[model samples]
Target: MRQHFFRCLKVKITKFIAAGMVVTCLFGSVSLGFAAPQPSPITILPIDRAKFVSGQLFDFLIEVKDADPDRIQVTVNGVTADKYFGKGAATDREASLATYRINNVAFKKPGKVEIAVKATGTAGLSTRTVKYDVVNPVAPKRAKNVILFVGDGMSLQARQMARILSQGITEGKYNDLLAMEKLSNTAIITTSGYDSLVTDSANSASAYATGHKAVVNAMGTYANSTADPFDDPNVENIVELVKRSRGMATGLVSTANITDATPAAMVAHTRKRAEQNFIAETMLDPRHRPDVILGGGSRHFLPLSTPGSKRTDNKNIIDEFKKLGYRFSGTKSELLATPPNTDKLLGLYQLDNMNVYLDREMLKNPKVLGGFDDQPTLMDMTQTAIDTLSKNPKGFFLMVEGASIDKQLHAMDWQRATYDTIELDKSIAIAKEFARKNKDTLIVVVADHAHGASITGTYHELDGKKGREAVRIYANAGWPTFADNDKDGFPDSPSPDITLAVQYANHPDYKEDYKFKAEPTVPAIMANNKAIANPQTSGEFYPGNIPSSDPSEVHSADDIILNADGPGADYFNGVMDNTEVFFGIVRALGLDGNRNVK
Candidate 1:
């Protein structure tokens, strides 16, 4: 089921140990097996088998539960934490928990390292030892640019739907392939975070950005025992390493609000993904700020005095960006008018998440758009970002996201989701065209997570059947009538006779109309204290297969596809953990965060 974006911090009681420590050669989290050791009073951040880019800064933290604050000792190898790093650590004493933290630290060497912590609690002595690996990725031919395409919530089924709609099939043979499907290297990526079976975008993207797994509702930081979301142990992300270590340009583009999890995780560090106001402010920080920022959520950038502003302060972020010499564009027409030589850009086309391709470009109904009608397509934003960021001679890292694939799917609108998926495919084509000239660029197209939507068969009313009766299976299910005569890669119509019969593996109580919605809608809504069918559409009622409170389809724990080409693309093959994506990018770019700091 689509995870309800939890706004509060979850109280976690972890055992402080994995099944067993395993050697990590840039593969994934250190813990390989399923069995975790018994509980310990002291829990450490950056759990066992964690890998890091050499010199990649991270916060070392040990959370001691019901322990004496002064009786805790942490050591790196044989040396004390403070003595090992030659930097002082901070210790906070709370009512039932205490935290010992050393921030802004990095491993100088490329080898196995150990962190052992001991604490004296009321019950007895609690101790744990975890191993870590630090590596300086090297490549014979390094990449100059890395364009990471995150198709948020786009499952394997989602890709097939896009292929079926954009590149029609004849007699079970495909006419063509989506741009992302043509990549030279591919791997099936596992999406779960260490904390849960299924994962949210923030946690999953954190794996790609930081090469470390984070809990749900968090990105760029591990969950801490404290109540403060920002105080979580922060891990240095790819944008930070590229910009600080190599002076590389960084860009973030998405169809969702720029402050949303998938894009924000590239830079911001927070335990809670819902902290958009804080994430908006994080963009201004020079340490890890992007050179180009595009997408919706203008409300977070506008001042509190503004009509649609979602900010709580009077600071005008747009104006702040302008002061930093960023060219601002509030509409599609203005975005295209941006000078080709423009380097820094901050474009916010809508106050909230931009309209999906179906409603914005296809329907063009201003009423459904909530007043901010002039939004640019994901392809347009991606192109502008590339044009601006590629001006930097040191190279660049850009994350372009089709954010609404998951959103629409949560509402059970696969038609809208598939159209957006096509939009992402076209955006990938834009990056592919750029890579054609610059062979030094590495393009990775993948989904942060996946939905449960699946194509079961084709539905048609030709035989005077409706609803479930019209769902034709096996040989009876002919090719869908979706046609893309315009050759723009998008079907002419979202809904047509002989449309694919899509089914959700997991869903809340909802009505199944088996039709495309003219207006975006949720299949279920709250009634009394539980979720019930919306009553807006008519068909067979799908009794809640998932939790009633979910009110929509949920995210799947199933693995998603990863496609890549260009330099460092060879690193991807066979099944891999999600965190390996970060390692792959650094290897392609030859980025080593190891640095000499006093």
Candidate 2:
């Protein structure tokens, strides 16, 4: 009886073990049949595509949404910014937020900057990453001095128009040539930044100033999370590097405000270009301060108590410069009469942009700043900058920008844009003349970007029709008849018997009145956060091709022409990237002082 009972117990135990195995297999199959719920949306924009300069400062940020803060993790090339930048990150756990920012982090050697951010939540898991290439230091060839001339929005067609108007073409032949036409070296540079195909003046100029490309409206820095424009990672600019490393003098001259995008890029770094007030203040930084600064927009340097000042404080930058031994001149005569031997010069001719060349020198239009009657031309500013900078025995770097070409184009004023192009050419002429005497100077004439303006043939009032109907094209597209009999280097009248019919590839719907406006017209204005054609115009309407959000014709992703002369200029041959311009300038100056402090 005992053996029979033991046998029954063993059978019961075996049966229990078989039942447990069956239950386990069933649960495994059920789990295999179902999938996890999808995670919330997440986006990652790569910042690592650029070839970053070693030891340069940049931002490291990761964007993630719908994930719990406690579950998010960030790593830079497998390391954290806490370890890279030596700063601990703070997270908002209560708000379900996660953010990691590393400012002024330096890449010690040439390689790659790979960033990985991983997040997991109740929904699921996701990851995003970016990689950046770092390059070894390249030693530049020796050059005594460098002059960069920026023709704001001056494209090849603009150059052609200026040549036709200023030089007068006779039956396909030209009478003389533009001053920039005789450069010893030439190259076609493709201009674009990391963020977009088309770049604004600030970002494009930043690429030239710092051997690195930044986003639109940014100068010498990249966009990162933060409301403070001053907090962006700073890249050492030519103004700072040249002065600090080689003791070289630096100067910036422009027809627009000295704090304008093109000129400010040399010393300022901010994600937003509209921060002109802050940029003006940054100009006072001892690192990148210019030896000679000449331009318009004196309002920014004056105290807020001053009626026309643009500053929000009583900083009085003019007084600060004067206290620092700079000769402050506010007029053409004052700039000219100031002793050339003065080591520092600061000239501000107007509270706003200087008068256009046509108005300042020829037409004498009284509408814009007529009170400042003696404002100097771009040529005058260029000559003065050269004279002041040349006083430095250690050599100098001067950047002269004719900043109105883009401004007039934005206003849809082709004639004004043409005149500004002429002004830039004249500035180049001054530099070329100086180069003739001083072979040690490297002179470069180029545009930061291009406009979409093109010659749509000729438009003659004698065509017997009106507006677009009279626009001459194809076989009827005869050459324009712009004459310069006085040899003053400008057409006596922009509207000749035959004027070139230029059309904007991108613009708001507006009247096609083929006549140049005596006063500038605002093409579009903001209405309900959208740019609409100005309702206050008297001409027929034409629809816009670009989005209504744009108030004016937009910039094109077109290649720009770079003309160069003097030593180390040969590097600008063939088609090159925009960043290469900065390299060319640095290489010309042999700036390998390694201004980085560990």
**Each candidate: how many clashes?**
7, 3
Q: How many residue pairs of model 1 clash at the backbone?
A: 7
Worst 10 residues of 1 by lDDT: 4-13
C-alpha-based local distance difference test score of model 1: 0.90
Per-residue error for 37 in candidate 2, Å, reads 20
Residue by residue across 333-383, what tens digits does model 2's lDDT show? 888787868878889998988878877877776776568888888888888
Every candidate's lDDT? 0.90, 0.79
